[model samples]
Target: MDDRRELPRKLAHEHLARGDATGWFEALYAEADGKEQVVPWADMQINPHFAAWLAAHPRPEAAKRALVIGCGLGDDAEALAAVGFQVVAFDVSPTAVAWCRDRFPASTVQYAVADLLKLPEDWIGRFELVLEIYTVQVLPVELRRQAFERMAQAVAADGTLLVIARGRDATDEPCNMPWPLLHDELKFIETCGLREVSFEDFLDQECPPVRRFRAEYRRPATITSAKS
Candidate 1:
């Protein structure tokens, strides 16, 4: 583990001990006190796999609205904006959201503080592209399925939802912070009415070569309905 991850792990344990699953995020961000390095996953750049995915896909101007879940530091959201997306990126921590706004003072992206577990009603089926990276795995196992359901429900008709996360086998023990996801858990996205367009399970170019899963899904448009 990167020594930087230790603080969050400690914070999580403390919060979870108090039966607070989500509060740890705000605590972690607040503890960082504007220092990005204190947050383990703040890479400060668009994720390479995500960049490659964007490059491979069609850049249709018609599909413009995008949403990013748990967008710490806003790198992915900024990348989407650069590619012409009208983006909404959110984190559970207000401190993190403030950090993003301060880092990109002129950004058009709407960086808000919102909990994924309790999404707003207007957000359901509202986005043309949804990006979720490394957010769900940080949640407790009991909440993972619901988190996935919220993500799928946010996709507009015929829109895309791209998910990137640490991969794990069904038999593997998820005994750490950012608990990796099983293949079956990943398939829960499909259960929420999206069709899988592509799926990749590979070892990333990290220092120790971490395994990653990148999956693309799209909600089907039945042809009789409006974009609504």
Candidate 2:
């Protein structure tokens, strides 16, 4: 396996052995220091799908609340802020969060260390847009439902939740590193009371293209939710 891929799984297996599913994130980020490739997902740029979405839509006239799950190096959050979204980007890894702060000394995006399973109560149903790019697929499969539920819950009424992930058929063989998400697993998002807006299963612009799912879901407007 490529070192880019092997290192994370190696660290993950070690942490998982000690009954820690999330700790390896800090271990990997800490070990990486400032080398982006050391942490494979740290491309140090806004995700292309995210960039494309922003291009298609008009920029926010005001500061719309946006959240980035497992923000890694914070490029996505910065991009959101650049487009006038009030962005809050978080990672379970404290080292990664700290690195984001250091990297953007003057950034307005709030970079916090947070766990998806137990998100900040103040964040629930608060964001007008939630970006969960490549976060869910990295976690152990068993944790999928809870993470999806929480991501869904983060969207305010009539707000959008955009999930970008590697996609695999239910029959695909189990893989490593960034494991691909099964289509059926995503249904849980709808169960969390968000309606599917649109879903695209396509290949990205990688050298060797990879299958990806970019799904959008929206919370319906109701009597409440969304505090100023």
Candidate 3:
């Protein structure tokens, strides 16, 4: 297994780079529909920064239900379970969902094949915690905003949302496919009504240059209890 930390940037970003158009996803996923190695979610692991952040930001005791967007092979979802969250992760590709289920058969993680932008309306407001990692970047610019809105709508009131994604600096290279979010672009998520909790940057430049923006946002707690 190639450690995600050691893969070339092109390898890690291949699917997104190849899937640049709004309709490119269907074809990409279709090609991978039944393949096993097509989606290597397990290969993408939590780095020291993410692990440390998870250490301090405990999953809410009341938040037993969680939804993970674009969960590859359930690595992060498994991490969530280890922290007492009941997780349901979804990916656009059936290959990814199948890979995730097989990867964690004995674990409590659940995965489905679904398109994020066209998710069922009932899914809205259903999750106490929604985890978005690298999905928005895969989308075309025209669709990213709408996809982000859907992600925001999934969070339950008094719940939390966490995003782990590649970010660009002012001097970053031009990106088309797998377009990394610029600082201002990320700030746009704030308009969705999620209160910003904290944001941190994780920089790893071993083989595949890894620079991540790990952000936390919370849905408002109206009751204002001691826990609040």
TM-score of each: 0.95, 0.95, 0.77
Error of 2 at 89 (Å): 0.7
The stretch of ten residues in a row with the least summed lDDT in candidate 2 is 1-10
Our model 2 lands, by Cα RMSD against the true structure, at 3.1
Candidate 1, residue 163: CA error in Å? 0.6
Q: Give residue 183's lDDT in candidate 3 (0 to 100).
A: 65
lDDT of 1 by residue, 1-228 (tens): 469988999999998889899999999999999888898998899999999999998776674789999999999999999888899999999999999999999998989889899988889999999999999889988899999999999999989999999998977765689899887898989999999999999999989898899999999985786686
The parts of candidate 1 lying over 4 Å away from their true place are 225-228
Candidate 1 weakest ten by summed lDDT:
56-65
Task: Decide which is better by lDDT, 2 or 3.
Answer: 2
Instruction: List residue ranges in candidate 3 displaced over 4 A.
Output: 1-44, 47-49, 223-228
Q: Candidate 3, residues 89-186: lDDT per residue as tens digits?
A: 88876766776776678988778877788876878888888988877876656777788788888898977888877788878886644567776666
